[model samples]
Target: MASVSSSRSSPIGKLPVDVFDSILSILNEEDRDTLKNCSSVTKQWHDRCVRIIFSSLDINNKNTNAFPAFQTWLSINVDAAAVVKTLRIWKLPVEIDVDQLASVLAPLAGLQNLTLQFIREPQSQIKSSSPLSIQGPRSRSLNTLELLLPSEANRSMLAALTVICLFDTINTVGMQGFSSLKPDLRSTEGLTKVHQLRLQYLPQACASEEMNMFSGIMTSAHLRSLYLECHSPSSWDGLRILSQTFVNLKFVDLDLVQLKNCVKDVDWTTLWKALSSCAQLQRLRINPPSLVDALVTAPSKLFQTSLTSGGCWEVLRELVIGPGYSPRAESLPNRIQRMLWDLPGIVRHDLRGPFPNLDTVTVEVPLSAPMQKRDENGRSNGLAAPTVVSSEQVKSAIVRALPSLQEEGLLRITVIGRT
Candidate 1:
């Protein structure tokens, strides 16, 4: 392989053919051959393959006692832990001591991301942050934290907050599919990353707790990029608070899919007011069917007064909107219309500075999901699939809806498929 010295090019693609072949062997599940061949290829390939393979560690002690495997084998300055950047703990044994787990994780000095996924674990809230407050050889700061606590896990919202406060400095945090949290207003200083905070698909149960948690976030001098899914009135008020303190937000993903059922509760006037504070905003994404309707049907006056001529998202360069699916739930379009009737003429006229500095406008077509088929037992797939919507058709519709975007050559269209 004469390609060894070609480091100036793409770091991964520049690998020699033999090295790629070893990687292909692994992808093809020739695991025995892969371990043998990859290690034997070259010292460089050996280290690279090991790093790529173990860069993300998943621990589950319930089935195979995976924690011990890490302690006895991978943690060896065989230095596998040195390459681990993402750590996921699945169903950490309820009886296991946190101190023991902390010691095991001490060797992952390069770890930057942590995910706590509770699967098959008994319902018990973590009592304190001590379990996650590691005094070890690992890096002191984590860049991201994600909690995937589905209903099956009997999710304890308190446990979620406990894990978050452990890191002295964490930049990004995501909590998905949670039901409710017992109210706790105590603040922690760790989440000071002017980067991102995402809370999606949460039920409208704990409005007070939601306000407490998110309002505290609003007070953070370090809070930057935020994506919140709010269905209740109080939570939207939290958005009003965000407007007052959103000093450094650069990117915002506003997914209004959950608004399908609770659109009435939202004060569009308040939402527009909140968006007016993103003085540093560079990207704004208006996502999905119901959200499109919400935007289109909002009173024209809300847009007129909320943003000033001198301020409000003037620096925004990117705008993403739509999937021409009918805004009304009952009429799902099987084929794309000649015009994206759903989008109407809002973005070109209403949204930010009329987006004077807008550079790129992306329009996403609804995913082309094949119609679901029933099995011989009369059971169907989980998704009630829809007819495939062509990207070309969607693009054409978008051009009709916003002719200026096409004329100015700022329009781009996308259709994500079932991967």
Candidate 2:
């Protein structure tokens, strides 16, 4: 009994410190919970793992209290904020206290990315104070900022922009679900080092005021990549801002989902006409930049009329038709066929045909089209399940419609996200 007790109590051969260190170093954010549980294993391990685990702080409705707790803890332990490199807060309508926001962010000297998606409409009556700038060269490490669903660019948004000015490293700034009904434009003035901009989901009837706000704050010459997606046709008119403001633009992505009551509601030529006004573009003819990527949801007839006659798509080096970047946008079957055929004598015009650079038009056809199957009466769009159309039949249909691509051995079909 005495020998048995001694054997059980004695420590087994332990892993060497270097081997244990090697194993712990291999752990990443995916093993965050495991790290949290094992932090007490060693003092050195705790210090190293804590930084890795807390590098990204995501605060949403589920963990609303976590932000405040972190705020309180960071107030006492200033060094703790250094570990956090990214901060995200989503679906929370809490009033953004600008001064408090600055105070919280000031200590996070290494914070590189920040995303705020608040479910609130800015009220005109909400009083605001100038954002207390978090001054420090290290604070400039912030590189990406995504501001979504704020609806209006009020003082809160302005304060956020002010905070952004302290960080010149910020390369991308996204403003989504914003309308033209913003506060006075004079306040949003600042020169940002923004290289990429995303203006998505703007409301109908966008006008000069909303578009002017972006041109006022951002540097036109420095901007390179521009992405615009909205339901409003007038939003294209806003693209005029790029003509003078963003002169150095190299790439443009558009996901315009026009509101069509009937078949003829959308003017097929409107989008191409707007794009014709890009920086180097002339009045009638187009000498657009190298790339113009779009995920247009218009009908095949619209594409047939527009693409052939609209502008010189022959300049396209890369083009993706079906659901390239936007989920809300879709490509119909007939639209792909329209893209394939080059009807030279169909119209009196002889401008568009035989895309020289475009060898393959990569179209991503979602299996959800037939697999999930959309319903007529349901509010929910699609539920991924099974197909009414078989993969073999789909291939056969493609072969019949587009024989040239297959003959050249450039055609390939893939079915994804369905068992």
Candidate 3:
């Protein structure tokens, strides 16, 4: 038995440190929990495996039972905190003192990314001098920060959190579900240096003060990439600010959605004007909201006229439209055919200027159609999901439009389905 066991022994644990290191390095984030168990097998494995395991921490207040233990671990294994490069806090726990949490994270000087997602209405107004305002040592290394706020979240809290230890080194900022933040945040030292800004879920009918505050934030930052997604067509108050500011802007993505009743010609014209004013923009993506109508009388002429009148997209290299849904009076196949035949003509007329840097124009079509499937007997097939159009026809439509495009390799089509 002893001889057999000796012959069957594994050499994985005894491998050279570099070999073991390479193996751990290749492991994906999902394998970290498994690697954590391996960390206990031997001292050599523990050092490397533990470091990798603690590199990213996801702390959610919903997991109430496990949080205290996590906090205690951070307190005891102070060195482990140093390895954490990414920290995500889903919701702050009311029971735990923010200062204590800050203390636990104080040693995380190497932290590079932080995400704070808080939507819960505060139990009480958080004072400017609240313990949560206490700065931690590692806040200086945090460069990329994502702030997710619920509509009801206090703007003061958003400003206070932004001003925390995180204010010093943050350069890239992503905000979701916040129509506007405190105007005072524009004066914060960190926001002025931001280069990439992404804002999503902007509320409809923004107040003048709120628009000013949001505009101030955008204008103050020397943004290179600005991505905005709005809940309604009328919510894009920041477009005016971008046209005048963000002189260094390179990439812009506007995902604008409108209610069935809100689609108007002025909206499209406003959008085109905004695009024209961005003289330095390189890549542009416009995902128009789904307009539920029997026929969205192909605004091809309007698009051509507006784009031609507005100045040329001087450095624009790539343009993408849709993953859009437009319900027409005709059948799915007919509508697809019309869009394919019409889009190229629109592009030919609209884009007559010197597109020296223009390269690709992408039409993104959604696989799911707005119509119901029909059976052979012309009855609604309730068992099957709705089919708008087939993927092949969509691709063919893009292929047909290619010849009309200014550049040969310029036309591309992308089809995205419900995730």
Candidate 4:
């Protein structure tokens, strides 16, 4: 039993080099302690295990003293910092100085991804340098950056955004919870080619201001994808600005959350009117209530009149509607069919052309109670069920309305709901 126990704990160095590499490659940062134990077994194992352990670093307070401990470890073994490719610093302590954070990040020359979230009370005048410590004229290799803040936008947070944007390698950025956009964000030269931008958690009062800020920062030709998660009707003003500002935009996703003060019936005319300018738009996802409201309130001749005026969405290809609320009207299918058939011509007039590049439509509806099947003896064997419209029925209705879609097989309809 003693011999068996000793053999079971034999040195990791006994394994073949290929086998050792494979074992280390499969283990993530979660297995850091086990990897450290393996590294202590022998010199060869040390190189393999340490590289895997230090490849990505997450610094946060949730683990209790993890950031300080990592700083201490990094100070002792400075070479390990070069192995880091992804760094995440979230929920930092207010007591930690910006200089201290800078010094810790300076060693990561190979870092490619960085996410920073500072939630503590804001401090003024922290003179932060470029987070990446790359030297010489060579551009940074970092590709993605994510900045998350609370609903309030302070001078300190804007300064952080400025410091981060100094890096030329970032091609995509996702920012959330910023209540306003400062003009300083527009001076970022590195954002010229930032093709993808995500703006989330926009509040009602700040919607117009944020749109103005974004319009200033993003040049029309540079931005391609824009996503907005808004909490007010003021989103219409922002969307209008975005449509006119980013003419080359290919994708747009809009999520309008119902705010406490907003009306139950939203008017989508402003949003649709804004969309009229996006001639290059290929993909769009909008809240279902907007479309439902437009059809319910607007006259059918309004669409025909708009078609004659030459306002159409000719380049649109993909559309997605929401997990919707129940509409006020019962003839939803007919209204939807009428809008789908005539929407292309409503925004633009292109009689010689196909009018739309549309290929796919996705609708997410609420599930309804299903009817139960009964058995013999007619003693109420759970056969009664509520009458409900199925997704298939909706699909069939759409196909019937547009028979050309059925013949061409170019249109793909996805209806998601109860079974």
Candidate 5:
């Protein structure tokens, strides 16, 4: 028994510090909790494991009072706070006293990532002040900043941080109350370094003013990706601003359900005129289904003519068009097929089913046609009417369309049918 016990403990004790660190890195919160409870087994393990496990701190209103206590603890154990890499504070309903927040933020100057999701009421009006007044210690090591302000007005704290150049990469900056922000994002210095921007629930009250400010940021040429989610119809102005200003955009994800309103006012000629300038665009996704519905509902002749007159679908490599709530009359698959047929550069077509690339054709055939599947002598079963296209006809169409596809060295074909 003594010999077996000695062998069991030897391997764990012999593990290198780097191997232990790697194992600890992959642990989730529960696993880390277990490790922390067991840290007293050895002095070397206790020192290294405790530091790695407690290197991230999350604070919110529920434990707001604890922050001061944490500061007191950190004063005695400065190395503990200095090692923290990620700091997240969110949804503090009450206005945080700036002095209190500054004290907590001061010790977190070594943080590599910081996220703040602050809630402020829309009706509440606060006097404007220069963000410079709230500047804290600069974090030269910080690289990512995520701000989620639910109120329309800017958070003076975040604006101040941006002006002070606290972050280097500025990975994601999301604004929830965009309509409420004063249209002077330029006031926050170093915004041009932000690579990803997301605007959620645009304020309906002040559309144009907010959009103009948004346009100024996108025109900076350094922005690489944008995500816009409009909750109200009036927020469509931001889409118009993007369509007009962000000509050099390479990737865009637009969730503007209210885009139909913008489409109503859009001059196809002028809209495509601006879109054509996105010469390097590689990926584009439009959501909420309304945009496609609007396109299909437009008089067919007008839609076709607009496509022929230089639309923006010429260079797309990947396109996703559904999983949205739209009317059945807007046949997305048929519309996509038409668009691909019209665009000469679209060599690959991926749609609803087995049709992988347009080079090959795939078809699904039912074991029995609706008419043939009727209960006696092929008469109506008095149930919902079945589709008219037969499986054999669909297979025939594939054979028909194959010659043209094969001419491009695409003879591969797949067929699937349901009984």
Candidate 6:
């Protein structure tokens, strides 16, 4: 047994070089690149490593000289071309001639992921022989597509829109533009596989109308996961529309604080109704004002009723109450306690709260001083002890309010605050 173990541990008696090279070829490009750099130290390692490292290529610069060289390299290494799984081409000064772009991308039929960025301009006229004009059906293995637009105002909106609308099999899509436009699903009807969508920097216009359109798109597509961040107030109407449409959603992360101006005139009641309707919600993260206020102002019957009485909080697994807006020194803890207790389904009684299934509670607290350490003798070290409420007291209040939940299996609680 000892002789067998010793032989297995010896790298000198490992598999032959060809077998090792074949194994390394299966790794992703980042790992393959590392192996390639290490292989260059010796002639024996160089031949085995270079094939895997150069198997995938990224052409990022748009300079004329690099483009031709890249084309030449591709022509000389036809076998290696089939191994490329990811392609990223960017910084093109002018809108690429549709035919030229297609010719470059055609050889990469095996590409599973593609990214095009920094398109300075897009052509108004589609070349008759260009790939852009190729309307016949073509099968592609592409599943993920990311397009980044230049920040220039004169950028070609038509070309950018065309490129985005063309990907038929994309399952994940990300775009950064002036406004998050819901893709014309009609244009990419074959993209039924798409489940994840991200929209950033959406322009604020007539918030209500745009939001309605956006909601219509989401409901029609049955998107499962969504991330939306907008900086303009006009984006609020869109958010409100989403709150109304995505009631059956499972996961959502909304950054509405970026659109402070749009929310200035927000209808709190409508937003609350939208939040209450999300019956299948598993994970949710939004700024405090949007989520906390809705819970506090929800109908009294919703909170007062038992868990089996169609209360919305019964399904919630996690609750996070963030910091208050500009808390006053005199009534900070009072306000925090009131907000915590007032939360529907959360009880002040010893452990009989409505959140029976709640396993975690996160609350943001503010501190006036640094925390002090306790000595082994059970005495305070007195290192300018922070004027903060005791965790035990807070825990006691929670335990008393929802004893039933704690008894059932509640185990973890976290309080987040600034010192």
lDDT of 3 at 226: 80
lDDT digits (tens) for residues 53-127 of candidate 1: 667666655553566655765443345668788888876532334555566666777889888765434544443
- Residue range with the least summed lDDT across 10 consecutive positions in model 1: 1-10
| Candidate 2 TM-score, true structure as reference | 0.63
Model 2: lowest-lDDT 10 consecutive positions: 1-10
Instruction: Write candidate 3's Cα lDDT for 185-250 as tens digits.
Output: 334333335667777656664454655554444444466888887666555555754566566678
Off by over 4 Å in 6: 1-52, 55-57, 64-72, 92-103, 122-134, 138-144, 151-161, 180-188, 205-222, 240-248, 257-264, 272-280, 289-419
Best by TM-score: 3
Off by over 4 Å in 2: 1-42, 58-72, 90-99, 119-139, 152-160, 182-190, 240-244, 256-263, 277-310, 313-315, 323-356, 371-387, 405-419
Across 319-389, the per-residue lDDT of candidate 6 in tens digits comes to 55444332222223333443353442434442235454566655544333233444665445666444444
- Give the per-residue lDDT digits (tens) of candidate 2, residues 1-419: 00000111111112124433444466665554455455346656655555654577665544445456556656654544677788886664424554455656777877778887765534423323332232434236457898765555434455455555656656888876654345454543334578878876656666677567666667666677777764655555677654457655656776544333322344546655555445332111111111112212332343345544445543444444332221222223432343322221222242224234445434344354433334664232455453355445545665666566657654555555532
Clashes of each: 1, 0, 3, 9, 3, 12
RMSD of each: 9.7, 10.8, 8.5, 8.6, 10.5, 11.0
Score residue 345 of candidate 2 by CA lDDT: 24
Q: TM-scores for all candidates?
A: 0.67, 0.63, 0.72, 0.67, 0.59, 0.56
Error of 2 at 266 (Å): 2.4
Q: How would you encode candidate 4's per-residue C-alpha lDDT over 358-382 as one tens digit per residue?
A: 6665554445423333345323234
What is the lDDT, from 0 to 100, of the residue 197 in candidate 2? 81
Q: Is candidate 3 or candidate 5 better by TM-score?
A: 3
**Model 1 pairs whose backbones collide:** 352-355
Candidate 5 lDDT: 0.48
Model 1 sits at a Cα RMSD from the real structure of: 9.7
- True-structure Cα RMSD, model 4: 8.6
